[model samples]
Target: MPPALLVQATAVELLALYRSRSASPVEALRAVLAHVERHGAPLNAFALLDEERALEAARASEARWARGEPVGRLDGVPVSVKDLLLTRGWPTRRGSRTVDAAGPWTEDAPAVARLREHGAVLFGKTTTSEFGLKGLGDSPLTGITRNAWDPRRTPGGSSAGAVTAVAAGFGPLAVGTDGGGSIRVPSAFSGVVGCKPTFGRVPAHPASVVGVPPHVGPIARTVGDAALLLSVLSGPDDRDPFRAPPPREDALYLGALVAVDAPGASDALDPSGALDARFLRRVRVGVSATLGYVDLPGDTRACFDAAVALLRRLGAEVEEVAPPFADPGGVLRTLFAARAAHTVRELGPEQRALLDPAVQSAAAQGEALSAVAYLEAERQRAELALAMAVFHRRFDLLVTPTSAGAAPLIDGGALPPSFAAPFSLTRQPAISVPMGLTSAGLPLGLQIVGRHFEEALVLRAALAIERESAPLRAPPLRAS
Candidate 1:
């Protein structure tokens, strides 16, 4: 395959290329590095690129592939991680000028360590919002991470760089964290697949300052790729107090992917990449266009309705449903602000000066909350979770727009409320898959939410939708 095509290959496709000797890991890694270097500047999607380390690992993977002794599931595949996570040798600046760049960067975050263990060619760290505090991409440190679809637009952030990098073919897969909508919002905006596995399904160390609401997840062009990476990232890690127990013997992430493509799977279980509609039949899917709070925009509503209709046509038992609980927006805001306050309080005056004003404002809001108010928010959260738990008793899945609309212009209105904050509050597994693009060509993601630990079902359902929807096209850089 040509180097150009190599840069666009999916993780599964790249693995096949390595196994067949059609492409070496070094060749693939170099191709990606070049592509990212050439086209990545406009989007400013990368925080740091470790070319030497990535190439060295790629060479070793090439040797292993030559001997038919691949190290693990993601052997030879180049992957990017959001900078919020630790990387043993790289500074995790978290897109904050306040973070020191000096020595003492040690230990990989659990997810990063797992990527290394799985033989992934760890390459780069993507940009993120300051402490992942805001919704749009620009941070005082990394500047703006423009949407790949149109450099003028915002790639709905905190995981801004991760989603843009994945969408632009910087790498086939990226590790992203969602505290609120970090992963899914950016994925929805950038036209990539993003999944926030049930809280703790993928462990994180030094627990997120945002508390139990944040989750580490995967970003990719295909649901199968995300599931493959999730399998590697999901497992017991003693460092995370919030880690989920060992995955049930019956509920593996990749098993879901394989089942989603059963008749097409081979001994190698190579992801077919082609969409299959065999899944989702008889699956009870509940649809909530607005979650009964935010006013749904006309364009996004039309797009979402079309996608939901398609789900019904695919044999899903679909039902229109009212919001299960009262609007939790205020509760979410309180929890979010309180966490921001906790994080900001630890910073010294000098470091605080470097923080984004939005972060400061959010922290200030948090600081004003009395202990009683904070507890009230927590109480509301408990009630909201219970509401969803009971509501799911009747529906196998919940579908909503990942974001209220397409990526907004960088200088225009903010990306509308994703209606995603509520599900994040529930700590259930949810995925954002590209359903289609707006008439103007921007991507729109359809979100699928599932019960706790039901990641496999989420992925299976998303894969079916992905297989049936019109595939999103590459950005202009590679456009025909």
Candidate 2:
């Protein structure tokens, strides 16, 4: 197959081709590397590209396929890790110059370890905001990661590089960490699919200081590909004290479990994959345009209304509902500020000077927080979680616009408003899927949120939307 078509293929498609000898891992890696080299710099998508090691791994995968002895689920697929996740052989700078790229970079984060174990070729580490502390992609370490659709715009972040890479066809699979809107924000702006699974669903080693709000999950071109990646990403890791093992039956039959099970069903309603529409029949979806406080830009509101119309046509009973709680931006900022302060407490003056101004400001705010204030924020978070739990009991899913606006200019003043932070605070599973493009041709995303530990239901709903929505067009990359 030609490199253009090969680069655009999904992970599932690549696997089938590899097994049939119609395409090889080496070919895929070369195409991806070439694509990255030609367009990656413009987007600032990667912090480090391990070209030599990627080629070596790809060659070995090709040999395994030649012998018909592929190692594991993702045997020959090329995967990228967000710089926030440690990769054994790569320096995980975490989008900060304060982190020394030296020895003792000896361990992989749980997600990366799992991918390595599954025989995935780890080709590169993508960029992020300094310590992933901001919603926009610009960092002191890697500068700005731009939107794939238009280089002049910011690709929403802290999972900025991961989304840009996926949208630009540099790779089919990427692991993105979301705390606040990190993953889904960029996914929305980049016009790709990103899932922030229930907290602890995908284990985190050296757990984030930001607490339970941070989740590690998949960002991909399609929901099915994200599901395939999540199957490997989920499960317990001893390193993460909060990690919980998904139910055995769900893990064993992921594909079937996600496709036909009814909302809150105890038993599989249909395991034959023939009940796609029925899966959503009478499903109660609560639509909150602003989640009661976010300011919706005109374009995003129009796109979200269109998405509601689409869901109605798909057999879901959609209603406009007020979110149960007021905006929790204050609670989120308090916790995040404390976390940011802890992350940089030990930095020397020289190292501190290298930090992003936003990171510095957040740390200062955290330093000024009183013990009582911190405790109050925690209490509020617990209350918010309880409120969402109650809301979920009445509704099968919550639908909202992923961001308040389309991708903003790279030089625009602030990060676009997003509804993603509340779900992060609640530790619920939420996904951002492309709804449609704006008049300017930039993408918009519709978010589907489910209760904690309900990823299967969330993925099923996202897949239904994917099926009914217009297919996503490839970005007009200069390299392509």
Candidate 3:
């Protein structure tokens, strides 16, 4: 395969080439590095690119492939890690200038360690908001990570760089952490697939100070690729007290959730026609345009309506149903602010001054909360989670627009409203799949959420939508 074509290939496609001896990991890595160097500046997607080490890993993968003994599932796949997660031998500054860049960057976050163990070529660490506090991509440390569709627009973040990297073809896969809407927001804005698996499915080491609301998951160009990465990222790690124990079945259900080639009832059927039937046909989906509170922009609502129409066409039983709980924003913010306060409380005035002003303000607000208030927020969180669990008993999935609007202008300071955070609070699996481009040519996403630990169902439903919808278009990059 030509290097250019190889650079655009998905991890699954590249694996096929490696097995057939048509393309080598060395060639793919070189093409990817060159592409990143050429287009990276305009996107500002990378915080650090470890070319030397990445190339060495690629060479080893090539040798293994030549011997017909590849290391693991993602043996030669190029992947980018969010800067918030520790990557061995690389400084994870967390998009904050206050973090020391010198020495002892020795441990890998659980997800990163899993990638390394599976022999993935860990090429770079992508940028994030300072401590991943904001939805927009800019940081004092990395300037701004721009939208792939239009460089003048913001790539909704805190997983800013991760989605931009994948959308721009820097690599086929990226590890993204979502606290609130980080992963889904950017994925929707940049026209890629991002999955926030049920919280403990992917372990976290040195967990986010914001508590268990944060989740580490995959960002990819397609549902299958994201599922592939999730399979690797899931499972227990001793370091993460929150990590869930392995399921007794010892199965990675994602492999069976690949997109079906055809669009109707026949294609939706599981391998055993009797046992599972067509998965989508049996699924009950509840469509909530606003989750009962968010006021979506006109264009965003239109896109979401179209997505719902597509799901209906796929033979799934769909209906509009308001979620049982009220807006949990107040509770969520209280917890988030408290976490922010905890994050910077130990810092000296000089270090505090280095923090993002918005984050600083949130931290200050958190500091003012009484112990009673904090505990009350926790109580609210528990109540909301229970409500959602009850709601899911009647519905197999909840569908909504990922964000309330398209990407904001680069100079536009405000972040758009999103439907992603409530699920984070509930710890349910949610995925943002590209719906289509708006009339303005900006991307929009349809968010499909499943009951807690039902990642397989979320991916399977997403695959159905992916099959019926238009292919995700790569952004037209402006000349640097």
For lDDT, the strongest prediction is 2
Q: Give every collision pair in model 2.
A: none
Per-residue lDDT of model 1, residues 368-439, tens digit only: 999999888888888999999998899999999998888999986666777678878888899999877777
lDDT of 2: 0.86
| Model 2 error, position 288 (Å) | 1.1
Which ranking of candidates, highest lDDT first? 2, 1, 3
Every model's TM-score: 0.95, 0.95, 0.95
Worst 10 residues of 2 by lDDT: 256-265
* Candidate 2 lDDT over residue span 1-480, tens digit each: 899888998887788788778899999999999888888778889999999999999999999999999987688899999999988978989999899888578998999988988889999999999988888888988888888999999998899999999999999999999999899989999999999998898999888646335799999998877887888888778899989776565443255233233223333424546336666878899999988788887888888998898889888989899989988999999999998999999998898889999999999999999999999988999999999999988899999999888888877456678889899998899999999888899998989999888887888888888887898798887653
Candidate 1 minimal-lDDT segment of 10 residues: 258-267
* Total clashes in model 3, counting residue pairs 3 or more apart in sequence or in different chains: 0
Provide the RMSD of all predictions against the true structure, rounded to 1 decimal: 2.6, 3.7, 3.0
